[model samples]
Target: MELLNDMALFVEVVKAKGFRGASEATGVPNSTLSRRISALEKAIGLRLLHRTTRKVELTEAGQIYFERCKRIVDEARLAHEQLGEMLAQPSGVLRVSLPVDFAVIYMAPLIAEFAERYPGIGFDFDLTPRHVDLVSEPYDIAIRMGEPESSHLIARPLASLVPRLYAAPRYLERSGEPKEPADLEQHECLNILKANTWTLHKASASIQVSTSSRFTINSVGLIRRLATLGMGIMLVPEAIVMDDLAAGRLLRVLDHWHGKPTPVYALTETRLLPAKTQRFIEFLKERLG
Candidate 1:
């Protein structure tokens, strides 16, 4: 529709921040772009944008309308891509968020393979330890660890991670071995955070150890380094410290003990996952299995 086209043009103009830029992006002349936006303002009967020689600025109505129109334009673009890709190739910018450690350990290889398979598709990935919102954020997909407390979004299980206790072999030699969880109290236990208590499980019996730490850090990488340096015993994920355990830099404590395990999920805003998202999720799921 003409109105839809005008709406789309207006959004582009605002986002691109200049009539000339929007015109170039949409392959329309700057004069035509300006006229279309004017027409849109007339039809809507609202001043959408404040014209400035330097930069375009959106009014309050413009901001509200822009959000709605942008989503519609995005969906329209996606619809066209879906149909075109049926015969051609999948091509779009995929915005993704992932947990830092998991991406470094697991997602790197998979993402590499995905790039090889879909050369047309571009990825914008954010790797942070913090959880990201699927609804409000622009991200198309997020790979998260553990069950999300937020019940609004759709999530598919990608993998499982179990807590693992490991310490440098030298630490055990100098500090003496802790045969039971209670004995950990006698040793300088490394805490990921200075405030939180550590929970360890042996057989079916769970032990809670209050930490006495010589060093404390929030970064998991730093914690692992301290553990490898024989500073103290550390508790982390099996997936995270598998190499250390194998290389004998760190050895597992209470091999028969059970630690809390968490499930990783591929989260999205919609149940109707995009093809790129679906494929990436499948790839991670397969790799995890």
Candidate 2:
């Protein structure tokens, strides 16, 4: 048990790249963390890390040992969490990174329900556009739209949101309604940055409609607001504009045609997840899938 504890400490030191950082992350004293790692090296009869004043680098033996120990520690932690779930409700601070617009517009109600279901759990939600570093950061998971760019992270698909063309009624009244996919070329479209084309699909046919806009947006919330304010037409998921549709702020265009389905994923650093994160992902899949 002591050996396992030491190995876990070693893994944290390597991940954090220094004793001070590992101490901050694990809430262990720097002296204690250093002592533990030294004891671990002595026990294993190998020097795992080359320590310097500025930082620590893993020795060849340390790198190999870290790879093996990380998996073992993760598995052990997972086993404990699984057992804890069988005995009681999974309880902990679940830190999650979410897309800003989706969390407010779509996931709010679902999150409320989840909170009610798991009274033992607390949450720290980070809603931002930045792609968080799941490997180095302490975030438990990140919910992202579209496919994750990094292949190193594990991505679990939660849902696919179908996008369709929509515009404020006032904008449609002035610009006139588009008759077909090609007609979109004539209208002012509100688009995300670098988005030049929108492909619309019917039962058997599809066409890529070239789009141009006066305003370029990077934020989904801002884009939705602009569409509601009658700036221009937008290709977005219905869930994003549900309130606008309900209030007659926005109306669907090209009723027969739809854009490509956008995928939502829960990104994590590893496949082995704690119960708190695992259950949260499962709940999302149940409601959103």
Candidate 3:
């Protein structure tokens, strides 16, 4: 690597026609350029330059070396410029995995904003509940709610969303509203999967209330929709239910009590991320952090 660097410096010095000129062009000091070129010639066991008081000229060996080194330097410079272009305006298909309900209910608008911001990037999104194999799959990244199951994958925390109780006005009117955390047991609670216990916090105090419901759902979108239709009360993030709240479909049940915060993570097979993936994660952190 050092030899290649010295070769590039030599090429620069030759192009400038003198050490002083090369120093001005490359931001390297004239003394440093002179020392490096001298070291380079010594390492190659050839006198590369015939230096006079006012100017420098290439030797017969230096002439041939310049031709070869010039091409190498030009190619290396092109590669660096191309990489800089990619960093500035990344262009490619960004394939990603996302949680279905969260993507639809929460990330839809954020994705639209991102798409508008990065016009050069194309998207390939997979919104599903099944775990994606990042190591074997062609995915750039995966956005998941709650904790990541695998320790092998790299997880970057985007946000932690605290869930609150929500229910349609009709359901609340019919079954009556709970004033305390213990009162949740008497009401019909809509659960995600088989989770029957709802742990809620108030100030510094906390309580775990046993819940019962006929509907056991895997999808948050479905559970939210069910809650809106007066099926039962749901514990979910405000961002997921914002539209429903605005439309008066659901209202906060226990105003002061909040469930545990669910962590949102961006999972990757490795920490070395491409420009597209890195930008997407940064955008999410800015908006949802």
Worst 10 residues of 2 by lDDT: 82-91
Candidate 2: what lDDT?
Answer: 0.91
lDDT per residue (tens digit) for residues 1-289 in model 3: 7887888999988888898889988899988988998998898899999999888999999999999988988898899999888676767999989999999889999999999999989999999888899889999999998877857999999999999999999999999999998898988898989999999999999999999998878889899999999989999989899989999999998899999999999999888877888899999999999
Ranking by TM-score: 3, 2, 1
Mark the regions of model 3 whose C-alpha exceeds 4 Å error after superposition. Answer: 1-4, 11-46, 50-75
lDDT to native, each model: 0.82, 0.91, 0.91
TM-score of each: 0.65, 0.69, 0.83
Q: Give me the candidate number with maximum TM-score.
A: 3
lDDT of 3 at 239: 88
- Which residues of candidate 1, in runs, are more than 4 Å off? 1-90
How many residue pairs clash in all the candidates, one count each? 0, 0, 0
Tens-digit lDDT string for candidate 2 (23-57): 99999999999899988888889999999999999
Q: Which stretches of candidate 2 lie over 4 Å from their true place?
A: 1-88
Clashes of 3: 0
Residue 241 Cα positional deviation in candidate 1, in Å, after optimal superposition: 1.6
Positional deviation of 251 in candidate 3, in angstroms?
0.9
* Alpha carbon lDDT at 250, candidate 1: 94
Model 3, position 55, has a per-residue lDDT of 82
